[model samples]
Structure formats: C-alpha cells, structure tokens
Target chain A: MTEQELVQRAREGDELAFAQLVTDNEKRIYNLCRRLTGNPDDGAELAQEAFLNAWRGLGKFHGESSFATWLYRLASNACIDFLRREKRRRSLSMTVSLDDEEEGRQAELPDQGAGPEERLERAEDRRAIARALEQVSPEHRQVLVMRELSGLSYAEISQVLGLEEGTVKSRIARARAALRKRLLAEGNFFGGASSTR
Target chain B: MCDCEKALDWISLDLDGALTPQERRELEDHLAVCPGCAALARELAALHRVLPELEEEVPEGFQQAVMERVRAEKVQALPAGRGRAVPWRRWLSLAAVCAVVLAGAGSLGRFWDRSGGTEPAAGETLPVQAAQAGAAAQAGAAPQEEAAPQKEAAGEGQGPELRLYTAMADPSGAREAADSGEVLPEASPLPTVGAAMNQAAAQNEDLTEAQRAALTANCAAWLQTSGLDPAEAGLLTVEAVTQTDLEAAVCPGEDQRARLDLDDYRVTLGSSDVLLCDSATLEVLGYLPTV
Candidate 1:
C-alpha cells in the first residue's frame, strides 16, 4: 500500500499498519528529530513517540496533505513543546555538545571538485547558517527546517502548520529573508559580492 | 500594492508558483524596466534558489523526530493500554479474582490490616509471609544488584521523557523458534543484532525480481530439505544490535511498552523492525519513505 494509505489505516487504529508507516519513515524521522533535538537519545525517544502519536491520531487525519507533512507537523509541535518545557524547567536550549556541529561538518562537503578557498567558503557558509539558525525564533527556525532541510513545498508547509496558504508563503519568504540577513550580518555572504555560481 | 512590497510579494509567490500568468507577466515587465526592483528580485530569487538547496541545520532525525513527537502525544491521548487492551472477558475475570480475594478475607482478623488499622496480630504473620513469597517469585533469577546501578543511570538522562520502543523479548529459545521462517541465513554481523537483520533486507534493492525469485526458490528448496515453512522468517542478524537491543535489555522494568508492529514481519527486534517481504517483494514495486 501507499505510505499515505498505510498512514490512513494506522489512523483507523491498525497497529500493524502504523508500525509499517513508522518503519517506512523511521530514518527520516530520526534524522529530523536528531537535527531538531540535537541529542541521539532524545531524538530516538521523540522519533518513536512521533510514530505512536501518528498511529493514534491517524483517524483525525484529513488526507489534506502528504502524510509526511502531517506527521512532521505533529512531531514539530511535540519538539516545540519539549523545548518550551525544557526552557521552563531549565533556562537552556538543552545543551548538546559540539558533537552535533561536528556531524554537520561531516555533511558539508559535496563530491565535485572545488578549490581550497571554495571549500573554506562553503564550510564558512554552513557555519554561518548553523549560528544564524540558533538566533532565529523557534517558529522561524522550524520554517527553515521544513522548507530547506526537509524540502517541503509551500502547500505542504501550510497543511503541516494549519496555516493559510498565503501565510505559509509569507512566513517562508520572511524566513528565507531572515536567514539571508543573518548570514550577511555574520559576513558569511559577501555583501554586494559577485555571483560565485 | 506598494512598489517595494510588490517585489517581496512576487519573490514570495514565485517559488510557490502561485503568481498568476498575468502577475508573472506584470512582474517580469516591472523587472525589465526597474533595475532596482530587478536586482532585489534577483537577490530574493537567489536566496530562494539557495536556501532549499543550502541544507539548513537540523539536529538529527529532523522530520522523523518531529513526526515522532507528534505521534507520541497523539498516542498518549489514546488509552495508554494501546495494543495490550485486555479483552472484556479478561478484565471481568481479573475483576472477579480481585473480588473473590477481597471477599475471602473481609473481616476483623489481625491480617485484615490494609492501611491505617491496628498493628498486625500473631495470626497475620502468615498472610504477610505469603505476600513476601509471591514478591520473591517475581524476582527469581534477577538480583537487586542489577537494578540499583541501572536505576541510577536512568535517573541521569531525565528530560521530557516518554516510553519509546522497548526490546525485551525473552532471551530464550522460544523467541528464536517463533517466526523462524525460511529466509536465507547469511553470516551474522558484528555486535550480533540477532533478529534486526530484516532492516538490511528491507533496504538494498540488489535483490531484483529474478534475484527474489531465486531467493524464493532457494528458500523453498531449503525449507523442503530442512522441513521449514516457505513463508517463515528463518534467521535475523543485524549489523548494529546496539541501536535496538541494548536499551531494551537495560530497561526491563518499564511501565509502558510501545510495541512496534512491524509490517508483515513481526518486530522481533526493537528499533530495527522491518516492513515484511509480503508487503513488498519483487511482486510489488517498493514505496520510498518520506525523505
């Protein structure tokens, strides 16, 4: 069956169907959770929890968007709730070590031939993104994660967030703008610089 | 719309492909003449082009994690007794057992002391001793030694904790014997993931249609030779048992268990559960997970 169909079945209280859905989506869900939570253990917990949550709430699913979008929205909401609770419980962003940054570094490279300076610039760009992302509001950061990292479309974003299509478009625009501003301010991008591409 | 805001609006709607044909024409017309608006449009377009491809920072399991947390809350809202909701007959039987036990001793005997009653009388010692024996039976082989240090370790990683998947299949022969259907058994991987090898099988589409047919033939041959079920899962061996096995091995005392009902294949391993062969064989083209 299709993932969406499996998801719909899962919503209807089909445990086996939902389990299949979780299996299908586990890695992406785990990676996304890892990025958002920045801890392996917490990510694991949250990823599994998201599956269980999806299974139970599957009946309420309206099939309005891709199942992944709906599922991620649910998970994103959960992560946000966790973050808020952590903020209340302890005024920290649940300090994960620089280990996650190290992993990000590992992912920064592409296989194409580039000069040393180009590599440096790319690394710098990623670092700039990492720092700038931390500064954005959680909502803004989430929009970036959904649109950029997850590569979701505007309609998908709207469905995931329960936002109007126009609102999703605007927020995404602002989020991109905000990211650009952050990177530029950090000098990660050359202001008025000529195109490297 | 204001000229400045117009550029922003166009930039925003552009990626979504939401700009009407007329709007696109109007915007392109504006850009053709207005150098400033054009530069700004180019800039926004550049940002738009870059961001999605730029690979924004995510913690780990970005989408999966979010969906998981969402799924967890929704699951929690359901009766926590999710899959294990005992049938009505079982519940009634349990209730009857409790009622009978209570009825058998509803009296002024010294052993009748449940909470704020007087001290236990001489005769009550036997009942207390019986209760202690029952408790001891539950702790037969496992000692208190294993619990103390483990509990401390669990206490250390406390956060917005929720019971995820647990991997506490009894480490006995029965687990192996159950669902030991006839798939080819390759050499086991390091750390011995026992039954989690189904994941690799699920991934790695090198086993194309002919290969699957060959595998099915091989399985049928092996099963016929060795008296195995063709549909049976023969043996599972995972590369990294660390992910699925270790945690569940540690947490045997968990109050809640979220059983992962692996598709077709039973979730013999905790984290490494697979969508079984019956769902997607060479017979069925596979479905990709949400990336």
Candidate 2:
C-alpha cells in the first residue's frame, strides 16, 4: 500500500500500519536525531520518541503535509526539546562535569587502528565536526540536520518547520555560517589544515 | 568586499543547490574578487560534503523497540481513552486525603472570608465537589456523607474555598472521569466539573477580543518572569483561576499570598513550570517547578 494509505490506517489506530510507517522512516529519522544531538544514544532515544509522538498524535495529522515531512517536524521538535531539557538539567546539576562528557565521547570513538596516526587523526576530525555541530544553537542545528544530513530540500524544510521559504533559506544560511564559525573557533576547520585567509 | 553580505547569502544558496544559474553566476563574479568570500564558500561547501557523510547507521532492533513502546502506550491509553485513563488508584488515594481536607472546608471558607479572598461566584464549587465525589464513587467508595456538608459549605458563599478543596483533592480527576465511558451518577461530579470547565471556556467567548488579548499578554508576561521566553509562551496554554492550588501542585514553593486581589492565572511553561500571575496586574505571583 501507498504511505498515505498506511497513514490513514495508522490514524484509525492500526498499529500494523503505524509499524510499517516506522520501519520505513526509522533510519532517516535516527540519523537526523544523531546529527542534531551529536550523540548516538540520544539520537536513538529521540528517534523512538519522535515515532511514539507521531503515533499518539496521528489523529491530528490531516495530510496537510506529507507523512515524512510531519514526521521530520516531530523528530526535530523532540530533539530540540531534549536539547533544551539537557541545558536546564545541566544548569541545575552542580555535580555534572565537563570531563564526564569528554570521557563519554572518547569511549564512543572506535579503538581499531588500521593506520594508527591517520586513523586517530580522522577520529579526532570526526569528533571536531560533531563537537562543532553541538556548539551551534539548536535551531541552527535543526535546519542544518534537515538540509545537510537528512537531504531535505529548502522547500521541504519550510513545510516541515512551518516557516516561510524565505525564512528557511536565511536560517539555513545562518546555520552554515554558525557551524563554520564554531569549527574555526576550535581550529578544526578544513579538516585541521592550516587556516587560510 | 562591500557586496560580500549578498555574496555570502548566494554562496550559502549555491551550497544547498538553491541558487538559480543567474544567482550562481553573480555569486561567482563576486567570489573571484573577494578572497574572504571565496574562502568562506570553500569551507561551507566542504562542511556540507562532510555533513552528509556523518549519517550513522540506525541501531539494531531500533524499529522493534519503538514498536514495543508504541504498543505499550496503546495498552495504557485503552478503555479510558485519551488524556483520561490515569491510574485511578492514585487518584482514589488522593481523594481519601482530600476527604479529610473537605472535613475542614467550613473553616477554610471562613478563613478565606476573613482574609478577604476572592471567593468564586455562587454555584461554582458544586461542580468541583461533584468531580471529587464522582472520583470517589468510581473507586467504589461511598462519599455521599462526606459530600453533603461540602455542598452546604459551597452554598454558603464559599466558591473559591470549595474549588480550592477540589483543587487540593483532584482538579483533573473529575474531567477525566467525565470524559471516560464509565457508569457515573447522573449528577456525576466529573460531568459537573467538565460542564463547569466548558462553561468557563464558553464564557471566554463572551470576553471582548480585547479582554482575551489582555489575558494572553498577562500570561506571556508572567511566563517571562518565570524564566521562559515570552515568544514561546504563545504556544503554552493559559487559563484563569481563582485559586493557585492546582497551579501550586505544578509549581511548588509558589507563594499563594502574592496572588493579586485573591485571583490569579496560570501559564503552562513546557512540562517544568506553571507560572501564576495576578489576574488584574501583570505581577508574577508564583511558579511550580518540576520536582
């Protein structure tokens, strides 16, 4: 059946149809979450939450936008909310240390070393990119994830976010600039090559 | 160099495949003379290429795990229907505790009168009481004897007092029970509670659009004081309240006394805080933070 047919069934509380929808969108949504959060675990949880929210709110989906676009909006909102809560939680908890996050991130990097020096450098570069993405504002991260990671066209992003196409265009531009600024600040721009004017 | 601002926009557009050929040519023309713009374009293009490569494999069994949670949520949502099927036992225990508070509602009424509290209008407390009683009856507890005196107290110009009683008891139980397809008393407290809320919402229509605007502004301002962006407050729900008891439940350490002239309003600021503001003034009264 077409996705719209599945969506219609899911709206009527058909779990099988909803599961089919979930199966279809799971990988893309998960990658979107991962890019937004810069953490695989958070990405996984947020992706699950996005699908669950979609299931619960299925009744409200009136086919105004494609199911995929609606799903993207939900996933983006979930990641943004999670990011905000994490910020608040971090502010509230005095015992949380920056070192803990660093240690956790280091553990996440692969230990396999086919070419010890090059592989380690590549891993460091990947970490720099992830860290730079994380440092950007959540709104910036959101548009960037949709555009770059999810391969959503500018028009699709506008529909997903309910922003004007002009707004999405400017936001994507600013997001890229913000990300570039972060990489430059950390001296990780151009894959650690020497900075050029 | 001065036109680099437009050039940067075009460069970003070019990276996204959004620029038309004309715009792309204009961007290239600008880039040829502007080293700064050229470098920025190259870096952003390179970043764009790297970003798509950052896509990670979805974890194993991810879809299955999500399906399991969805099924669990479906089970939990069943029979009682949406937003209503709470663990009724917890509400029953809360009802048991409120039953004691109801015993002293007479004195509480007097305290509000003596303290010059804004007692809600007559017949207002009946619905909330009906709600509590409905919850009690739903739990198979005989609350008739306990409900009788509170009705009399509510009759005696103790509108805010009894609603406060209901708030302390269970403001939500009545509405949820009313919405659920359960056998309830014809004058089921939950229905009365639901009707009263609906009536209140209906009355909201009677407010001139100006009044609604003022209420929204007051809510947004109060949310600002409670550490929320006023811009996002438009998305949060705002409601009028005579008492902050339920609001207090959501916002602990909220000073009820700071309420303006015995009345306050509430704004749900995400899942963390319910901000209470004075009904007449923009003064922020109290907030309940998530424990």
Candidate 3:
C-alpha cells in the first residue's frame, strides 16, 4: 500500500499497518537519531520513543507534509529535547565520564562486513567524527546531520524545523563549515595532513 | 570579481548543487588563483564524504521491543467497561488518608464548638430516678423501678448524685429548652442547692426535682476536678456531650475500645480541654488539651 494509505490504516487503529510503517521508516529514523545523539544505545532508544510518539499522535496528522517529513520532525524534536535534558544532567552530575562513554561506544560498535583491522580503523574514525560532532553546537549539528546523514533537502529541513528555506540553507552551510573546522582542528580530517592553507 | 570569502560560499553551495551556473563559474574563477580556497573546498568535500559513513544501524530486536511497549501501553490506555480501574495501592493510600482525616476531625470536632452560649448555672443537678424514667421512655420501655437498685448492683455508689451533676451541666437540656421556648430562670447569686434544683426543674420539665438536684451536684463535682482554677480560667461551662471513638490523644492505641460501647461522653469544657468522662459514674476518663 502507499504510505498515505498505510498512515490512514494506522490512524484507524490498525497495528499491522502501523508495524508496516515502522518497518519502512525505522532505519532512517534510527540513523538520524544515532547521528544526532552520537550514542548507538541512546539513538536506538530515542528512535523507538520517536516512533511511539508518532503512533500516539497519528490522529493529529493532517497530511500537510509527507509521512517521512512529519516522522523526521518528531524524531528531531525528541533528540533535541533529549540532548537539552542530557546537557542539564551532565551539568548537575559527573556520572557519565567522557572516557567511559568513549569506551562504551568502542565496545558497542557493530561488526559490519569489514575485517577485524578495518573494523577497528572504522570504529576509531567513527569515534573521532562523533567526538567532533559533539563539539558542534546542537543547533548546527542538527541541521548538519539532517542534511548529511538523513539527506533531507533544505526545503524539507525548513519544513521540519519550522524555519524559512533561506535560514535553513545558511544554517546548513554554517553547520558544515563549523563541523569541518572542528574536525580539522582535532587532526581527524584528511588523514592528519597539515592544511594547505 | 568574487573574493575568497564569496568563492568559499559559492563552493559550499556548489557541494549541495545549490549554486546557479553563474555562481559556480564565479567560484571556479576565484578558486583558479586561490589554492587556499581550493584546498578548503577539497577538505569540506572530504568531510561531507565521511559524515554519512558514521550513520549507525538500529540495534537488533529494537522494532519488536518498541512494538511490545506500544501494545502494552495501548492495552493500558483502553478504558474498561466499568471505568478506569484505580490501582490497589492508590486506593489503599486514599483510604488511609481518609481514615486519618476522619479520626482527626472526630477528635478535634468536640472541642471546636462554633455555637457559643452562656455557662450553665452552678450547683444544679438532675435526679437519677427522673433520668432513668426519661431513658426508659425513650427506649420504648415502661419506666423501670427506681434506678437505686440497679445503681447499687452496677457499683454506682452515688448514681443519683452523678446523674444530677451530669443533667445540670448537660447543654443539650438548655438547647432543647431554648428551642422549645422554655426560658430558664436568670442566674441567682449565691443560689442554694435547692434553688439550683428548682431552676433546673423549671428549665427542663421532663426531669423531676430529684433528677435536677443530682444533675447540679454532678456539675459541681466536674468543676472541682477539672484541673482549672476558676479564678484564672473563668466559669467552665459544658457545651455538648457527644459519643466519640477514643482518639490517641485521649485513649492510646492500646487503650482504644475495640467496640462501640458509647459509655464515654466528650464534654466540651468552655474553651478549655475536651474532658472524656464515664457517662454513668461521672468519673473523668481522659482529657484532650484544647489550647
């Protein structure tokens, strides 16, 4: 069935249709959350929460935007809220040490099809990228992840973020520049070669 | 004419394919001379290439776990035919709170009499025989033989005397008389026991002269043992006599009555303590501090 028809069925209390919808979009939502949170466990949990929220709020969907866009908006807002709350929690307590988190991520990295050496290299590279993404401001990181990882168009991001298209475009460009600067400063980009500049 | 800054901006836009043909050409012309801007473009392109590689897959069983949670939540949200079933723990907590409030109000309700009235006359009493007669009549029984025999068997030495004191201080008589248009004689200065008995008799016609005199003596005895110096505390008037469950303040949990015997009288002692006393013997049972 078409996504809209599936959404209609899901709205009418059809769990099978909703399950189908979840099956179709869970990968993108999970990846978006993963990139935004920079923690696989938190990403998986937040993705589930986002889908659950979408399920509960399906009755309010007016079809003004595509189902994917609406779902992305839900996931983005959930991640932003989680990040803000996590920031507050970190300020209040030092329970989650940075080294502990890094170790946790390294241990949790999935074994893709890559060999052991390649997997270790890929995990290290991922850790560096995630660490750099964490350095970027949450607002800029959000725009960058939605564009780069989720591959959302500027217009789609504007719709999801409730910003003007021009604002979205400038924010995406600034986000990329900020991320590149941070990555370069950390010597994680271009195989640690000194910048030509 | 585009400077390095504009050239970098165009290059960033070109990465997104957002640059127009003219803007792309303008950036290319500037990049041809600016190796720094050209290197920045290459680094930014490489950064973009690496970012998407970091996207992680959802953990296994995540979908099933979410669906399970969703199903459980949906089941809980569904309304039962009877109504929403309150959790047992919540119901128990609510019941406990209600019991506490009721126990507190029952304890405090005796002392906080909002209806203010004049003090009962001193030295007035109600006859024991008359009280028994009234009690018998109310119980739908023939007036029993003079209560003297029963009083003796019940270990009440001065049953008539205690009855007289209780009836004289009983505010219910005065309230009843007030409602029934019986104006009690004005307080007499240095009134003798006989005069007080007459006043009690005149106020409540239901009680005999002996009952009135006994009630007066009972009131006098209560005043003596009330632990309040009359000169300092002023005249201690009886407000209302009500039956109440023994509260911890009066009767500790170990001493609390297991059943409703109704033998205790909660005597409101004129802005003083609520004195719990035996209704038959007129002995002070316990005292609850008012202030």
Best by DockQ: 2
- Winner on TM-score (1 vs 2): 2
What ranges in model 3 sit over 4 Å off?
Answer: A92-123, A191-197, B77-291
DockQ of each: 0.13, 0.22, 0.17
Candidate number with the higher lDDT (2 or 3): 2
Residue B8 CA displacement from its true place in model 3, Å: 3.6
TM-score of each: 0.48, 0.52, 0.51
Where does candidate 1 stray beyond 4 Å? A8-16, A27-44, A59-66, A89-113, A191-197, B28-43, B53-291
Docking class of 2: incorrect
Q: Indicate the TM-score of model 1.
A: 0.48
Residue-level lDDT tens digits of model 1 in B72-129: 3321111112232212211211122222232333422332334332222322222222
Q: Write the per-residue lDDT of candidate 3 for residues B62-124, one digit (tens) a residue.
A: 889777655533422111111222222122111222222222234324323423232323321
Which candidate has the highest lDDT of all? 2
* Selected candidate, larger DockQ, 2 vs 3: 2
Docking class of 1: incorrect
Interface RMSD of 3: 17.1
Worst lDDT window (10 residues) for model 2 chain B? B77-86
